[model samples]
Target: GSFVLKAAHDAYVPAGQALGIDRDVFSKILDEKIAGHPNIEIVAEEVVSLDQVPRPTIVATGPLTSEPLAKSMAEHFGGDFLYFFDAIAPVIDADSIDMEKVWRADRWGKGTSDYINCPMEKELYYKFIDEVNGARKVEPKDFEKDTPFFEGCMPIEEIVRRGPETARFGCMSPKGLPYPETDKWPYAVVQLRQDNKAGTAYNIVGFQTKMAYGEQTRVFKMIPGLENAEFLKLGSIHRNLYINSPQKLRRDLSSRADEWLFFAGQITGVEGYFESTCTGLMVSMFLDAKLSGDEKPEFARETAFGSLLYAITEEEKENFQPTNINFGLFPPLTTDLDGKPFKGRDKKLKKQLICLRARLRARKVASYQN
Candidate 1:
């Protein structure tokens, strides 16, 4: 709480969009704070096993947890406790998206019209699939060779490999979302979901891939709205470690097997830097509460903190993937402060109201004292 984050406006996105920071500098700042802390230790030794760890421990062994400890963790946690790989989807600059080719709508018009769908005809979609089938993939390294791919975050290339039309049944499906101009269903579709509150970025939903960076740019540009797209991040797969918190851990992030054992960071199923950092901060509070018998701060359900916590701990138990704190995770806000329905589909104003609600409620969660 005492440290100041150094951030700069990200120029790649639309003006007043997301901020960027040098993560290396941020890590150095954290190191300085930890070094100055009286109770902390700067040990270089690696932990070999969970058995060796004392009770009331906060196990935050990151994505690349050492082999021996990983095994010990699996043995203790039981029931396919940890996942090994992270298939991350690519993000695009919103300003670069061609609004003409893509239309915003909820699937079947059943929910909020937040998704931007890019429709592709049968012939064109198959031709694009041909390119994806042949594109060069980034082969997994020796150490990552045995890592099993989870079905939930399957790579786009892997889908294409199953069959030419296999993708139509999965993420590329046009089942409910109608095609623009024709008012009929598209043969296939590529959906883009908003990645940040500012609406400056959208991610290629279910496009987590292992294609080479150059290949990703060349191949994905085949999509209708992305012909001249500016990619903020390319799809890639890496070895990551995250447990299914909804099934494995409690509300306070303590392991079900032992109340005193806590976990945090990416390993706790939160994605991105700030989400991980906040989880680490919250776990310390939970641990202190356990020791002193004090009530833990319960983050309000409407706040970003609570939305993220709900994602990891209360979302459907099946197909739990690590996630970033996003507006999509927030509880839906249909009416404004005056209880008036959103007369116009003004997304900016809707998001602003959610933010305002979070700000007002976050005080209670931040008020906890040890």
Candidate 2:
């Protein structure tokens, strides 16, 4: 019941290729293009109360969803709603960045040398670390209790707290990536990646921090590329709410008690932008079938969407945590490889195989839908 088989198949998609559904402007195009669908009507209105709307409708009031709606949702679901904190990294203006110290390269020169690397000497790196560790942390508001952060997106200071060198080994490690001029590796590296389509904004690559606004400005500029860095937005932390979906929701993404209401996006415990969008599509498909008097959409266990759904719907709830769409969630393939019974890197390859199977499965699903 895992989707690793599906993700394994998707592993070899060519670089720069887009997968899943085309979500960009297509969604608006869909709103216009399909505006004439007999059963479909897209309404542009905020529902202050779910009771005011029709029943059997979904309340996908995402993370920034309104308080009244959120409260109404909690009450309808009964018991307490689960929550987790999600963070957004600060955006930096491209023109303001000093290109002298920042070099663009993909680590090891992989596809699309798209990342901006800010090389750091040991002394300078330590100073940056000192400021990060000493920055003032904000106190979260009372309504944010259910929004504890997941380990993957923990702020830079939290990583620093683990050990002095934890961040270097993780986000800032300079191994394999070296400066061409000196043929020497930096002691640590700060990276920035373009945040939007126009490339006007870039985010501090691995520099998610909870530092106060004044301190974030004072500290982060110490890096080589950012001595005069102008910040479009400062980094800060906030709590997000989520449920342990594996224990709470089914593969159809419905709660145990209220099967009619489906969960989607980050709130369902799937991480990553694509993962959230895919869930929304899946929910749309599921609801589409229901509205058409057809059976609920049943995704093949071999698809990426299927794999992610399996992970969220199948893990132990108490121990279940948020997961991004990856091959690991797919079921292992029956490999003929004799070495070590298919583990480690071998397992990774198997995931690719599963993804291929998923692709084929998706083609079939598409054909059936058509």
Candidate 3:
């Protein structure tokens, strides 16, 4: 069934802030792009189930999939796929971090101290927890009320509701690392992890929240190193639906139970609009290769897109969850092509070297393809 485009009057908010679409603009763009395509048709109808569509179908139903279709998918895949309340953490511009108030360190000084740690004194920790508990949060819609939240992805407000000390014991734990200069652990700590290859942004690790956007800014800025932070993106939570891609989908994104059937987008366990778009592109490329009897393209594992595809198609199926593209998903770069050791170097420098190498590898792969 073809969905009608409804233009949203509000500005285009990036995906993960919510599943919002500027429907009117989006629809118009799609219509224009497909204007000259003869085989593409936009029909207005509701698709109730997989049975309604013919074989060799590509499903991109997205996060808000219809109930009947979701049920049909569950039956076809066998066993109930897990449901989770996913949350997005606020991203901060790198230059906005108060570097003097924060220290670079990883727990137990592991792996080049890649994280930025913000220490909070006892009083400050309690105050922060109180503010979080009292902050206004977005209310889940009726349909989303009953969905179970994955333990790993619990909202910060809900964690605070559990108990005042829950945050201290969990993500904010200062168990292994001592506050720099003072030589002692702080009452609590907040960690920020690099979000992009350029090191221009960092996300508050484990700070995924349901707090209203305004409140998120106010509360998060209270962290020691973020007082003057500029948020690139704010925290939010939503009900996300996805299949067990590792178990259900082949490397090419075709269903294991039926090779002709394929899936893409968030439904395939990758998160965000960009990730989903990449999956669609990959699926189309794979289909083209198969139909033309061309050699299957091999994506280099070091590249971001290659890493995301690996995450969805090859990662261990047990405890699998939807993931956004991140360096953690990429294969580690422990040595250079010449076999030189990459350990014991500065964290940021190491990342730079890895990124450079990945880009070179990607270029080489593209050249080979051409």
- What overall lDDT, based on C-alpha atoms, would model 1 receive against the true structure? 0.81
**TM-score of model 1 relative to the true fold?**
0.63
Query: Please, what is the whole-model Cα lDDT of each candidate in the order they appear?
Result: 0.81, 0.71, 0.81
How does candidate 2 score on lDDT?
0.71
The residue ranges of model 1 lying beyond 4 angstroms of the native Cα positions read: 2-16, 87-133, 139-209, 212-236, 339-344, 367-370
Number of the predicted model whose TM-score against the real structure is largest? 2
Better model by lDDT, 2 or 3?
3
The TM-score, computed over Cα atoms with residue i paired to residue i, of candidate 2 is: 0.82
Candidate 1 minimal-lDDT segment of 10 residues: 7-16
User: What global local distance difference test value does model 3 have?
Assistant: 0.81
lDDT of 3 by residue, 7-32 (tens): 22232322232333443455565666
Compute each candidate's TM-score over C-alphas: 0.63, 0.82, 0.63
Ranking by lDDT: 3, 1, 2
The residue-by-residue lDDT of candidate 1 on 1-370, one tens digit each, is 4243322122122212234343444556667777898999888888888878789899998877877887887877886655566688898999999998889887777556778899999899999999999999999888678776766678989889999989999999999888656679989999887766467788898899999999999989999999999999888887887887898889899988878789999889887767887788788878887798887778888999888888888887566777888889999897776778756578888899999989977875676542
Name the candidate, 2 or 3, with the larger TM-score value: 2
